[model samples]
Target: MAEEGISPSRQGRPSMTSSMRSSSFLREHQQYRPPSKPENHYGIDTVVEDLQATSIAPPRQISPFNGIPSPENPPVIVESGVSHELSHPNCTPVPGTTSFDRLVATLFYKSTSPRVSNAIPSPIRIPSPPKRAKSPTPHTESEIPPNMSPSSSLDTFPLEPPTTEPEPLDHLYGSYISPMCITSFLHLMSTFPLPPGSTDLNSAHRCLKLDTAHGHHPLVVELTMAPAPSLDYLSLSDLRKHELIYRFEREWNVDVVLRSDTLWRRYPRLVVFDMDSTLITQEVIDLLAATINDPPDLAARVSDITHRAMLGELEFDSAFRERVKLLTGLPGSIFNELRPVLDVTNGVRPLLRALKRLGVKTAVLSGGFLPLTSWLAGELGLDYAHANEVVIDEATGRLTGEVKGRIVGKERKRELLLEIAKKEGVSLDQVVAVGDGANDLLMMEAAGLGVAWNAKPRVQMEAGARLNGDSLLDLLYLFGFGDEEIRTLTR
Candidate 1:
């Protein structure tokens, strides 16, 4: 056998046959590399064929900085195991390192390692991601409770059972009802023992969601309960039960009012409002108390009493007297100063304007003195204004600290509401009362719809409905008026 070494060729040049064999040995023992093209997919057979057919090419010195093939040695394109040499293009080369260079280096150059298997490792079997959980249904069909006990929290009036079949609910003043609120309220109602008239808690209830222009949500929903002669206002007492209503109000922070759903309730002939805190932001008595500086902090002391009176902690008559006694020496001219400065509650002007446009008669029944109430009534174009009279001493030119006429306490407020309703020839069921204190509760109860406007806790508990929202304009919503409708009416 011939010596396994470089032998002299015919041209006196050392033969490269031995060096070629060494290169092949090195490549076979080198670490296996993957394909250059990311898109190239190879089975085990393809990988093995590629490894076997790859030819060793002459080493080309690639610039470390540019990673470009030298001009003397151009790129080799392999097609079907056949090498085709091509010159580098004249155009600017790709900026970054490419996979072709890497492939060429791997096939031609040798690294110190044993030959790697040609078989492609089993393709990674990644588990598919888990399915997402389904969301709960928005409205669940609530089951009616067996025993519907009457709530005993409110002093509700005796509602005469309908001797005739219940009337059709045509004129319904529906408001946007929360599904959560309705669901929760129904759940609460389930706790009550089934009253005689109501068939099932869920039987006659209807809920609808409609798109509206006025509210932020733009979606208006109304919950309509079937009329039940036995269950009035969801109360327990045969005499007066406000428990369920109060619990609903306290728990949900939303009012639960049961209406007669009559045309009269829908288009009320008269709407009465408490002047202080309801129409105007400040209590007129509290403002009058500020005029007395001789007692030093008399305004502060009287305001405390006024607060107590509004909260039902003190009797309105006695509290009025006490607060008035503090204002005995205050000048009547102080009313003038208070007139311009009195901050009206938000949305008052718009609400009144809308009510007037709707052909509804409006009134102000204030616990405050007549001067402010009458002035406010005149300013707001109210049809009627009733309030307590303050006796002014003609000689002293100051307040006498005595009421001239009958004190307009809780009973008087209710009386005034009834009187105004009668005077307008409007039925008692066609009157709407809105107020913010304990004194207003009686008036609110007597009216067809009694709205507690951001009232005391006790008042909120007792009133037919309570609204704690920011704007008085929201009252229009209770009348089943959309934003666009209210705008048109007001305009």
Candidate 2:
């Protein structure tokens, strides 16, 4: 049997084969037996009798062949009239058996035996083993099964999902400190009473404490909160008051308090204008170009480039050079002829008169040729004029296409604002700057108030306030002027 069919178990003992007696025993057990008249039957009977005489059971069938009885055993005999030659040819003896196989065979044989059918027990289903908890120690090479390598085990079971935790509150707060948080903290401090005999208000003390903890100067913190009522009682008798007042003045300048019904009361100061595009509808260069043999496209391109430069996209010098290059050989006489056609912007006369009557010294600061700026300034009765002088070729009387004086870029404009303020004996806070270009950013920054009139988006973002939907005369509203004052000034 050991030399016959292989056992299913990977590890087991060799198989055992019973002698011929076992075959005879099996044949005797069966009701039909071979007939004595057949010689083949006689041979089979002799073999079965010989196996039976040896007192051993027949070997269990393995496959279809090799089911012949052994020659030794003779105690068990075959029945008559059964054919031995007709057994299945493919049967073979079971081989390499183990205790497990023996148990399986016992169950199988008992189930098939007719005599043991009544005694056959019901299948006892073994319960599956409970799962064991994983050990804390990590598995190493020795712990894994023989068929499963480390890589194979890793493929079988993936890593556990990562655990995520919320960011700490301090880290989140450090990343983004809301303005509302500051206001809320101030409000919270206002709820507490001031310490006895302390001149400092509770809110001011809280601010000081916060500043001290954060290593910021107490005076700077006080200066920042000076406008609030919470810090009103703090002494401002020293130069600190002047600083605070200056700060307040700058803040008040940007705020359009004219609509507050307190403009004249809060700030009584001067106003200024830019002649081209600011006070007038026409740009002097475009006006000159429109009178030339040049197409309207030239004027449009110059204006568009000028507009973009003012909004801070291209550099002022670059835009100016590009624009001037387009008008390189044009006659200077074009300026003289187009002067009369320069259109005045809407609300100019009224806004000018309103500012004049309000005792606001009005001026015109222009990047246009002085001739055009001066003519417009005189026509409008403006108090002062500042503009570039256009150079002319001496022999041809044609335009040189170059400015003679300072090119009023942002820095020069800022200088002009400061110079005007100093010469007029007023602080920068007393002056109001209005313009619609990138070159005006410095001037706007210098003045106490900056008004962006129908300005580009960039100018609007940087300017203190914008006037898109309203007339220039609406500037009076910032001074707290009403419709009555407007009418009076115009009249």
Candidate 3:
């Protein structure tokens, strides 16, 4: 500085260090040199090392002129002080590259973009899934317009295409759900109105169509079609309405009319008979003992055990053993002799002929012996027969005091009844069961109509219907059979 030349110690700064230096002097003397490029040696690793080393060192003393807070003992206020100083006028951004304005604009109006408008707005409006067509509205008699013809009405509406999606709202709320329920509903609804050109008499007997959305169509109607009563021949309309009711009762409710007319007029397609007492008067076991010439005391014991076994009191095997033990010495030849002595009950041939002529499937499922039952099945033209076999001692050719194979007990009998119905291609409701013992209870319970034909006290109590005074033909009556039909069936 003494000679106004560059000093060796002032190599880091320009000579115009004094604040009183004029702007012109600074501009004239200042040598403006562009910054030279640094050597390409400091990499990301070197920069990280430098930063870590600096972070470990004691903080540098901040200048008051810098307007930054002091670095106190713990330096707790350093971050806050630096943030505050940067927010002030001293911390200006570099020009052209740094954009504080753009950042602020982004923060303020982020959601106002057109991209967001293209997205879904409400959660509910997010497309609804397609649904299946609803079940067709059930048709009632009232739904048929009085002047419209059914054929014309049918032609007016084409069959709807089947829906592929899940079921629609109406089906989720409709009352007529099942096929059976729809059938019953339509049947009941038919009683209300008659279609065009349909008389009450014709409408009462005609079948009605039941439509469903799920491709199920069925015809529902009464099982029988009979002429309606003539108002002139049985006129009681002038009398009190109750008197008309009584008069109708007098015509329809007469036993002779129902028994001799209605029931025999409407015969069933099937007839089933119980083996023990219905087809045969005496229980097969009693005839077996009589043929063996066993003592009365022993025969009575066997009968008691047989009864208990039939009533489901004792296990079939156990009861059978107990009964056979009494006949241990009885010869096997007695079975052949007993077969003929077995009492064929009254109305046996006539009942079988009637059932066969009616094209009815007749079966004999008994808790009795197979030999006896199979013989009867063959003789009576029975469709099927299932029963137990008595085990004989092979060496002695006499009773072994045991039963072989499955015991046709109550439960087994019930199983056989179902199997028969299935094999015969008949509805369980069309099958008939007739029995006279307590053991027959389960089979009776399973059948469509369980008739106790002159049954024991136990059997009569459990059966659906009872037949005492009438022959086996009385079963025809319960099936809506009339005397004319019964006569045709018998013939």
Q: TM-scores of all models?
A: 0.57, 0.47, 0.45
Task: Give per-residue CA lDDT, model 1, range 1-491, as digits (tens).
Answer: 35434343445866567545654675657798455667565665666555556554664433232324565435765667889775566555667832111000000001112122232233444444345845464323223211221246334423532122222111121123345555655666556555465556542333222333435332333444433324443332221235554544433334444454446545878999998989998999888877667768888998999999999999999899888877887777777778997888998898999988888999999899898888888998999999998888898878988888888889999998888888779887778899999989899889987888879988876777666656687677666565578778777
Of 1 and 3, which scores higher on lDDT?
1
Best by TM-score: 1
lDDT per model vs. reference: 0.66, 0.56, 0.55
Ranking by lDDT: 1, 2, 3
lDDT, residue 375, candidate 2: 78
Summarize candidate 3's per-residue lDDT along 178-252 as a digit string, tens digits: 334333323432343333444543222222222345344321222221222333433212211233222322222
User: Candidate 1, which segments miss by more than 4 Å at Cα?
Assistant: 1-182, 186-220, 227-253
Candidates sorted on TM-score, descending: 1, 2, 3
Which residue pairs come into collision in candidate 3?
263-481, 263-482, 264-481, 264-482, 264-483, 265-481, 265-482, 266-481, 266-482
Better of 1 and 2 by lDDT: 1
Candidate 1 global CA lDDT score? 0.66
lDDT, candidate 3, residue 32? Answer: 89
RMSD of each: 28.9, 43.2, 34.2
Poorest 10 consecutive residues by lDDT, candidate 2: 101-110
